[model samples]
Target: MFSKDVVRYHHGHDHDHDHCHEHTHTRGAEVENKDEKTLKILLLHWVNHNETHEEGFREWVEKAREIGKEETASHIEKAIEYMQKANEMLIEAKKHM
Candidate 1:
């Protein structure tokens, strides 16, 4: 049994936090602009890929720091830049779609 206040609290907000909920319910656009659905799917996939790459890069940087490896730190920095580029590309693609 749930309290009334609890139910009210859950339903009271009209904030943009509902975007996630809306996103789940909404279907992709039907019109084709370079195959919009496919492009959106690929962009989303690349976003995840870039995120994982960034995470791994961060982990590698942390491990290098722990080992006091300055040379490896520089290499990790370069890798981070590349990951950031990939992330930015994915973000731009999503915006266009």
Candidate 2:
């Protein structure tokens, strides 16, 4: 499963996690769209956030390859591609705004 899914599952049902601060993104559209300015800010934020994950996933891909997990590495590569596509779409949306 994806990291976000694991995060949501852990945080949504279990309250024993170490983190305390609220994640505003989890609230979705209602919380994100206060105005166009706020939405633009969130778009930039999400793009940066996804880039961080993509970097980490790339690192894990190398680690997986080292451990002879080529299949896992390939899957992570695919995930990186998806993240890039998402970022492109986000950038395009920002352009239109």
Candidate 2 versus the native: TM-score? 0.66
The local lDDT score (0 to 100) that residue 55 gets in candidate 1 is 82
lDDT value, residue 63 of candidate 2: 100
Question: How many clashes would you count in candidate 2?
Answer: 0
Q: What's the CA RMSD for each of the models?
A: 11.1, 9.1
Expressed as tens digits, the lDDT of each residue in 31-50 for candidate 2 is: 54445656676688779877
**TM-score against native, each model:** 0.56, 0.66
Task: Report clash pairs, candidate 1.
Answer: none
What is each predicted model's overall lDDT from 0 to 1?
0.64, 0.73
Tens digits of per-residue lDDT for model 1, 17-75: 11111123344553343356557766776677567667877888889889999789789
Q: Least accurate stretch of 10 residues (summed lDDT) in model 1?
A: 14-23
Off by over 4 Å in 1: 1-34
